[model samples]
Target chain A: MAEFDKNMDFPELDAYFSKTSEAADDRMALLELLKRGAVAYRGTEELRKKCLNARELLPKEYRYLEFAGLQKLIEKCKIFDLKNYSRELIKCIIIGVCYYTLFQSIAASAVIFILCLIVMVGGGYMTHRKNAKKLETYYNLAVELRGVFPELELEEDYCSEEKLMSLYDIVQANELTSLESAVVKLKAIG
Target chain B: MGKEIQWLSFKTREQKQADLDEYTRWVFKYGQPQKEKVEQILSRLFPKEAPSMAMMTYLLGRDAYYGRYNTKKSSDRNPIKDMYDVLSKKRYQVPKKDIPLYMALIIADERVSEALDYPPDDVLHVVAARLMEQE
Candidate 1:
């Protein structure tokens, strides 16, 4: 609502909020945090507040967020903000270009195809690198989760989105909690 | 407005204790072999000193979460993320592999680097990822 402050240096929300966003950044960032199982390590105040924000923005899968492929999922969301019907819009553009080029000149069609191929390759390579980084992050997260929950095991298939979601459920279930703050009154009473 | 936030409710003393009472149980009860290995690793890393409370808290927390003694409220928390947040605060390096072990040492032994301050992240991504690979 308030431009979301591009450089808002709130460490409390670093692991919880997204760095950049338009309007949905909060929602997306919360989703990202949930995917990384931030709910596990994140403290009480932050988790509760953020979950409240996410409850409306995200679907029901917040509790079972998986680190795997979430970048792509987020990217898909980002794509939507760029255009109303981005996928359909692109398809229309491609079809229009193809028809024009086919009638204009066969040589032009080949040239356009080559150009499109190069752009596609460049885009693809960028996506690949991005995916690799996200994958490594997922692995690192798996390692951290494994540290606490050995049953997570970090098997070869552990990186799969669905499998990781299951593991995240275990993380949520096995998180370490303290009664220090909440039970202070109770302890004093007893 | 949005749906009311249903963040996890805090556990009472009994509930919290019911969820997590002791750290030793990981070593003695569930993760005996891994505990030994982790202890050996800590000892080897810091021959002069034992791990600090912060480090032990995370290590043991992780073990208990994975082990049988964990509570139902355990699902609401995450020791790894907590530890990483603390460990990553330091302005130094941690290893990519066995980060949990190394962060425990770094947090335990403040002498690891001069730049590091307290309150590292709860989850240790990679030992070196904190310093060398800051995302």
Candidate 2:
């Protein structure tokens, strides 16, 4: 069995396959696609046929499981990528060190804590602002629809008991929050 | 060789519709009143524009999952159980301290609902429980 190299890029894989394995890049690409869930295994006769046909196009030794092994490597690289974890760990350590240093000086610690709090609050506020904009967009779209369909009387006649009940049903079924339920209610009313 | 991958069958159109219908009925029974309360909160939060109800519903659902539902752990040290410790102490009056958490929960719920395609009513119950639990 070939040892899987985590550090190897696509080009490296291609080179290795071309030199050692008999399978061409096309077979590799198909396997890669399937591994990514871009193509479904079942009910995909065309793809299955393509893979089968392509197998003959390649060397017999560099067939089925070899192709599957490469696909699994591709998936493993995607799933267990340590970059995000490494970055987060580094950030936590840096923050911990900074806090420790700040604690050495009580005045500095207070300032640092306040600064961190401000940053967190500001970030939260910014997020809320973004949500507000989304709400505005939805509101504007509703208003525009009302303007276009004035005869329908969207705001007034839009929310029938049946519609409200139905919307309520959707909220309950999904087990949504009060705010979520309200939003559905408003949509039904509109 | 590893275990063979088994592809689950997709739901039939009729089955999907029936599920949707059942879900909708449950939501109506449980979700409507909670929605009213959320609307009141939203109106207070954003006095300028009439807040989008759809967005609110979506947010509420998301928060219910992320904040409350997702926190459920099999271990004894469950953070969800001690939710009241972090919630507002004031029983009747909505304390200024608690409002932020409430608002945050609402926003979180919306995102979860949108991502999961959850029904609004289920989200509402979760939100109500989180809110009332604080009291």
Candidate 3:
């Protein structure tokens, strides 16, 4: 392993260390554990248990590496979940009740309620779709990231977000494409 | 109508050259310590056809120094992708197919610059050696 000039200033590194160490508690312990690298960090039972317990209060995603920039990019990519729509549904109901109570007109109340439902649910769905696309793009970015930094192993498969149809490319290959000629040649050879 | 080509939106030659020059200056100034290590790894790995330090430094620092890795510059493209695009067009003695390896070097170097403070700098050498083993 090569040695870095310890005297150099690195705000990004310091910021990440302080933030993550603060999150996990026991700054020295977390730093020591991180020295083992992200892949090895998961396998260490006692340290991992301690970190995981502490991490639970922060967010579901683990800080896999001390690479602050990459970690921040990963954090920005929100995992799409249908469960997030439940809040929208609850909002719709509240709006419907309010409309009915205020107007005293069932038709107007129903219309307003439906409109609110459509707007809220529709907006949520649009955002979800946009996030899904963003997630796919993020996955592709991750695939490219791992290509260069192979040592950094990710939990998700690189191709997990790729659309099935985009996986293969069709190309021309003379004899391979000419089924009839190939079949005739095959028959003659046989 | 056909979709607008994204490359059309990319910076012109003068802009790119200016960016490259700025990046090169930054690398020379701050990356002096890592230069020997990078050169050492390059010489060891590509003994027969080592790339020039100028090219390596340019590619390594181009995005990281410019803060392109930050989320504020939101775009479909990234540092690795930009490097890949450059490598494809330019003859850097580095094959376009081996982008992953170069990318690893560049990214590891970027991490160091960004101060992945805990693992220490030896990790960079470890990564280079590990990559060498794989090659």
Candidate 4:
């Protein structure tokens, strides 16, 4: 709970920890070592044991540099802009209802409106849910890839929202082949 | 009686890797694409330092939450409240003070920063926000 010594000079602390064996007592020094990606501490047995203990004392998320690094990347992703999505969906339903009221009888419009609402909400929810799930999977894969290939720089391969959106569209387009197959079967039967 | 402090727990390695096979399949299905557009935008907006997209999003979300677009009064803005709103939207349960510390830890961590390499005037924005709370 100690405030980061606001004046804590990085270069000076780096020098201090690099030279002294007393770094094990300093949480910041342990963090410095973790920052250096020098997890395998090559030091005196007492220093190494103490450093290990210090690492254990640090937040678990900070303990593994890879997780911390990958997490930084995953955090970049905007899985679902839920607020924007709901706002747009509501605006759309309002407009659709107004159009229906102008064009149809009240009883018919009410039935149609209820059906449209269900379809719009259910369909929107499913699509967003799928996209969110896909993005989460993508993030987890990025995280796990760090462990399997520590040398790999995941930032270079990070997916963007635009790319993912386009890819999802392409995947959906490809999925239409199943519908095509069913149509061909029906045509032959007819 | 003194209050007991409970430290945060980490995910177990086994739990972490449990669905690696499924994850690999998913990643392969989606395919990894380089975020060149994001890089371009970040480079243009923050020519000096790389503020992670997460940081950028948090700042933007904070502004949106405050209806900054509609308000002209500087007194109406509250950075601490905005920060909490953004964190809550993400469902994070971190302590307010720890939030800045966590940001500083990641920003200063060399290995992590290397992965997040870009540019930031936004870095100053982050530091300023933290210092604002300190004062």
What's the lDDT for candidate 3?
A: 0.45
Task: Write the residue-wise lDDT of candidate 2 on A1-190 in tens digits.
Answer: 1222222223322333344333223334433432332212223334334444444443344333332254443344334333524544454455645886857765665566556544554454554454444434433343443343233232312223333344445444544434244355656656
Q: Top lDDT: which candidate number? A: 3
* Winner on TM-score (1 vs 2): 1
Alpha-carbon shift of residue A149 in model 2 (angstroms): 58
Candidate 1 stretches greater than 4 Å from native: A1-103, A151-190, B1-135
Taking chain B only, the TM-score of every model is 0.33, 0.31, 0.47, 0.25
- Fnat computed for model 2: 0.00
* DockQ of the candidate models in sequence: 0.01, 0.01, 0.02, 0.01
Task: List the global CA lDDT of all models.
Answer: 0.41, 0.41, 0.45, 0.41
> Which 10 consecutive residues of model 3 chain B have the lowest summed lDDT?
B113-122
Q: Over the stretch B9-122, how does candidate 3's per-residue lDDT look in tens digits?
A: 577889878966775565544555455666665565455554675345444445543444444454533444454444444555456435434544565455443222223344
Indicate the worst ten consecutive residues by lDDT in candidate 3 chain A: A163-172
The prediction achieving the highest TM-score against the true structure is: 3
- lDDT for A87 in candidate 4 is 59
Residues A1-108, candidate 4: write the lDDT tens digits.
223332433443244335432322333332332333322222223433443444454344444445454344334323444464575567556756786769856666
| Per-residue lDDT over B46-126 for candidate 4, one digit per residue giving the tens place of the 0 to 100 score | 454445644455334434333443343556555344434444444544444434533333233222221222223345345
- For candidate 1, the per-residue lDDT at A32 reads 46
Clashing pairs in 3: A2-B122, A148-B104
